[model samples]
Structure formats: C-alpha cells, structure tokens
Target: SNHQSWVDTSIVQYISRDRLPLTRFFTKFELIYIPIVGQTFYFLDFPMMRRHSKQAVTKNPALAGKDIIEAKRACALLKDKPFTLLNYLEGTRFTPKKRNTQQSPYTHLLKPRAGGLALAINALGDEIDGILDMTIVYPDGVPTYGELWQGKIKRLGVDVRHIEIPDELFASLQDGGYENDSATKEQMFAWVEHLWRQKDERITSMLAEFEE
Candidate 1:
C-alpha cells in the first residue's frame, strides 16, 4: 500500500529511515505514550494500556491471570490484514549512554524483549506466517526525530530480511492452543531466541562491511 503522495512531495528521501519507508500499517501491540496525542490515537480506535507490572499481577489477589486475557484482546484487534506493528524492543531510541549501560548483545541492536512477540505469536497462531526482521543503519549516525525534521541528518542504510517460520514451530502453533498449550509456547519462544541470535550476527557482518 504505497501512497503515491508520499513519493510526490520530495518526501521519499526524508521518509526513508535507513531506506525503510516512513509510513506503514502495523499489527500486533503498539505502546503509545503521550497525554493529548494518545487520546487522538484512542479516538481512532488504537489500543491503549496504563502500563502495569507483571509482578503486581501475581501478587495482587484481584489481578491474577490477566496477561493472557490482555494478549487475547490484542489478538482479536489484529487478527486480519497485513499490518506492520512498530515495537522498539530496545524500548527506546539508541543512544551511546543507554547502549553502554545496557551492554546490548547485538552490536547495533538493543536487547530484544521477547515477551510481547511471544504473546503476539501465541494469540495470532498460524495467522501470521513469519516475521520481517528489519535492520536500520544510519551511515551518518542515528538521528533524533527533531534532527531529521531540521534537515540535519542525511544518508542511511536499510535492510529488511524476512525470517521464515520453521515447520516444526508452525505445526506447534497450529496444534497447540495459543494460551493453553505449553509445548507450543516453548517452541515459539525458542524460535524468537534463534532470530535474535541471527540478528546479532547480521549486525556484526553489516558493520564489518560498512567499515570496509
């Protein structure tokens, strides 16, 4: 669904983030934070969360067993159509201070939090064929949103790799009920871990190429 307007306004270059298009539809969970801004999103029918602790759910008498329920609700919202769900697994933009503090395993990636992705796979089950693992490299250096707007940033490299879901894992999802089946959940988790490992390797290879 490429919008011709995006290309017509000399926005193609500005819109490309590491060569990836700026606007795209997303499925799965999107965590939106902003007071007034979030309200507009809600008006448009976007899912909003108050941000609760996973531990609190276990300790509180009234809050037990809500994770599955929430995940299920999200699944219902995104069950159809091809959409891109934007998730920052690093949970935020990359910065030298944060990156060093986190000691990220991937050279250019933030450590992936697999829980959300796990829930998405469990909820969607076979509905999603696989994931498009994306890598955004800023040749000139990562730019803040403001910098990009000010026309201060230039040059970027983008790569998109489609990671195929292995048959075993797909079968596991098909046979095992997303929430109730333990085996399928474990398999999906393992698959996500494998993808993260490959991503780390790819980042290293890409950096080497950039240097050369």
Candidate 2:
C-alpha cells in the first residue's frame, strides 16, 4: 500500500477486521522501545525489523543482508498461522520532499520495494490464499495521527482488491528463486513496479472524485 501517515495501521485494521484473519505487520525495531503503543505491539507479537541506514551498513559491512535473515525468521514463525501480513511497500510515508529527493517515476508514490513481498511469497507460498492490493488516499489532505483521533479527517478513499500473480513469477517465487536467482528478483521488482504505477493512477482518480 501507499503509506501516508501513522493512522494507516488503524485504517487497515478497520477495513480488514471482519474479512481477514489476525493482522500482523512488519514494524521498525526501534518502535518496540516506544511507550504504551510499542508495548501493545510487542504483546501482539508483531515482527520488529531493524533497518540499517546505508551509512551504517557501509561502515560495518557485516550489517548487510541481516534484515533479510531477520525477515525470513519472522515469516517462518507465521507460516503455520492464519494472518493478514501487511507490508507497506513504500517503506515510509509519502511527502513531497521525499518524492523530490527520490525523483520517483510515479507522480504520487515512491518506488515500490519488492524484497519483503518476495520473501513472504517464498516462505508462505502454499499456505496463502491470495495477494491483495490496497490503495489508500487522503482526498482532503494527508492527516496527522492526532488529526485522525480528533475526527478532523473527513474525506478519504480506500480500495482493496486481489492481485493476480503471473504464473511464471509465482512458480519462481515459490521455488525460492527470488533469493538465489537474479532474474527472478528482477522479475519480482518489475511486477511490483507495474502495480505501483496502477496505484499511482488510481490515487489521482480517487482524489478527483472528491473534487466533484
């Protein structure tokens, strides 16, 4: 999904409450140190991932690829369970400043990351039901977490639908080619980029409806 703000987690939960299984999302490791909310996440058993900055990885070279190992371990733990694994492909919230910095091809998004999705597919291929694409738009404007609690965000748009995985790609991912084969990784990246492009257009159309 296109992440906008901290409120996205609640919105996701609200939408999937009755339809999906228990929701478990990948969270930043540092978040576990936060107050009550962090404790709640810990108690709920959400996966905590440490994302090393580029500079940090460069300095300690050994830190490279650690997140993947951690992510795989997390996915293994969830393989036998029924749960909605929510991954924010953008990796962070969207801001005009960030868009400019990234020089992203999509007008309304950052480049989508495929690593997490591939890992999930590789780990839980047989157990999964389907992959869903979720698009969220703040038609009025992106709201802060406080604004959400204050009932200040009046207009919003959310779309959720199943995403069909290409047969060849699906087979490759299920076989664990994503990590072992460079071509499979590139294919996964391309597939997700296509999804992000559609999402970018959808966001534009969704916001246009609010104007009318």
Candidate 3:
C-alpha cells in the first residue's frame, strides 16, 4: 500500500535520513481516536491536533472566530524550524467509488476542506513560501495501511510539483484579518479552488501519459 511506498519514496526517505527539526500540525482524530496506542504518541511531543466541528463552530459565536487564532498559535510554535506539517485537505482518502459518488470538484482528489489550510497560511505568514504538491499514483490499485505494512502491495509512483502561492493571496493575508474579513476569505477560497482545478487537470494529463 501507499504506506510502504511512502517509506520507500525519495521524499520520505530523505526526511527520515536526518534528524529534522519539525512539528506536525495535523488533523486531531488521527492522534486522539486510535485504539490502544494513542496515548503513546504524546510522548513524542507532537501537539494534539484539534479542529472545531463544522456544525458546532457555525453555531457558536465564540468558536466561530477561533480557527485562525489557534492556527496562528500552532504556526508560531513551529516558526524558523525545518518542520513538515502534513494537512490532508481532503480530510480522507479517495476511492474510485467514492469519487463517483461524490462527484468531487477535483477529478484527481476528494473535495478539499479549505478551512484548515486557510488557517495554516494565515498563521505561517511569510514563513511558508512554497508548497510541494505531491501526487501519489497507484496504477494497480489503492492499498490500505495494513496491506502496506504487510508488504503485500508494491509498484507505486509519486510526482512532486513545487508550487508558488500567488503574491495576491499572500498580500491579502498580510493585510491582516484574513479570517474574519469576508472579502479576503472569499478571495482566498476562490484562489484555492482554482489551484485544485489546475491540479485536477494536471492529474488527468499525467494519468493519460501513463496509459499511453
């Protein structure tokens, strides 16, 4: 599965080779809801990822404004450090059937949950200037984490594209209050949607190339 492939890949291998200074600001449940070994993760000093539930946040006036503030604090903790923050925008993996059922805006990816990324960017500010957009391709089929651990699945490919955020988006954030400002939030959301659209196009072209 992709887990083993991830271990074998250049990106993961390179990161593992060095004792990198990094903190992961990931989704909360991955750390909290695990069965027996969840508590052990806290020993590593990885911050407990927390995100407000969509419904709860929307309903509560106090919580509605907390996302950006919390994200800023998280980003502040990681500033000037060579750390990797893995945020899964889709919030879950994709299967072909799910893709069909969801009719996602992006052909290659599940629907992106934009709120987390928006907060991260607002928090990180100029600290994060580039993004390495990674595409994991499983020509045979998508594999589960268990399959990957057992060494049952193999033959995977990865493509990395380093994308620069357009200056306008950065400038908008720099103006301050991106989260609370309705106009700025809309602009950022539109920009991200455009990026996802392009990603869809790129993935389609790449898959066609592989087929040929």
Candidate 4:
C-alpha cells in the first residue's frame, strides 16, 4: 500500500479485519525494546528486521545478506497460519518533504522498495491466496495519529483488489533470485514501479471524486 500516516494501520484493519486472516507487517528490530506497544507487536509475531547500512556491511563483510536471511526466516514462521501480510512498498509514510528528498517520479508516492515484497513472496507465495494491491486515500488532509483517534478525519478512500503476478516473475521471486540475481532485481523494481504509477493516478482520481 502507499502509506499516508500512522492512521493507515487502523484503516487497514477496519477494511480487512473481517475479510482476511490475521494481519501482520514488518517492523524495525529496535521497536521491540520500546515499551508496551513494542512488546505487544513482538508477541503478535510481527517480523522485526534489523537493517544494516551499506557502510556497516562494507565494514563487516559477514554482515552481508543477513537481513534477507532474517526476513525469509520471519516469513517462513507464518507459513502454516492463515495471514494477510502487508508491506508498505514505499517503506514509510508519504510526506511532501520526503517526496522532494527522494526526488520521486510519482506525484503522490515514494519509490517502492522491492526487497521486502520479494522476500515475502519467496517465503509465503504458495501459502497466500492472492496478491492484493491496496490504494488508500485520505480525502480530507492526512491526519496525525491523534487526530484520527479524535475523530477529526472526515473522509477516506480505500481500494483493494487481486493482482496477478506474472508467472515468470513469480517463479523468479519464489526461487529467491530477487536477492542473488541483478536482472531479477531489476525486473522486480520495474514491475513495482509500474504499479506505483497506477496507484499515483488512482490517488489523483480518488481525491477528485471527493471534490465532486
């Protein structure tokens, strides 16, 4: 999904809770140490990833590929359970400042991150029913987490539909080629970028409907 704010979590649950299985998402490893909320997420089986910087991996070559291994391990844990795994492909909430900093080509989105989605597919592709593209729009302005709880947000739009993964690309991702092969990685990026462009246009259209 194209993330907008913290409120997106509740929105996703609101929209999917009944229709799907248990929902899980990836979280930063450090979150587990924060407080009650963090501990709760850990117990709920959220995948906690410790991402290493390129410089850190350069310093210790052994650190290379560890995150991918960890991600696959985390995903495999959910293989037997019926679950809806949500990856915010943009990797973070959208902000004007972030958009400019990223020099994003999309009018309403950041570039999609391919690795996380690839890892999920590699581990859980067969267990899941289908891939879904979810586009969320807050027709009122983007609200702060507190604003959402306070009932300040008046309008929202959410679209969720099945997306078919091309067979060749699906096979490549399922085989873990996305991590090891440059061509496969590029193919994944191109596919995700195409989706993001469509999502960006849909966001524009969703917002327009609010105006009318």
- Estimate, for each residue in 4-71, the C-alpha lDDT of model 1 and write its tens digit: 11221133333344654332322223434556655555554444433347678667846654665665
lDDT of 2 by residue, 69-183 (tens): 7877766777766789898998889898899899999889988888778877776777778999999999778889999899998878899999999989998988878878999
Tens-place lDDT digits, model 3, residues 92-140: 6666666688887656677766666666676777787566665666666
Choose the strongest candidate by TM-score. 4
Rank candidates by lDDT, best first: 4, 2, 3, 1
User: What are the models' TM-scores?
Assistant: 0.67, 0.88, 0.75, 0.94
For candidate 4, write residues 4-68 as lDDT tens digits: 89888888888997799877898888988898989998888887888888999999999988877
What candidate 3 gets wrong by more than 4 Å, as runs, is 1-23, 29-40, 174-178, 209-212
Off by over 4 Å in 2: 50-66
Worst 10 residues of 3 by lDDT: 1-10
Q: Please give the lDDT score at residue 24 for candidate 4.
A: 83
Residue 111 CA error for candidate 4 (Å)? 1.6
What do the candidate models score in CA lDDT, each in turn? 0.54, 0.86, 0.61, 0.87
C-alpha-based local distance difference test score of model 2: 0.86
Model 3, residue 161: C-alpha shift (Å): 1.7
Best-to-worst TM-score order = 4, 2, 3, 1
**Model 4 — which ten-residue stretch has the worst lDDT?**
120-129
Query: Candidate 1 — which residues are off by over 4 angstroms?
Result: 1-36, 80-82, 99-103, 171-189, 207-212
**Candidate topping lDDT:** 4
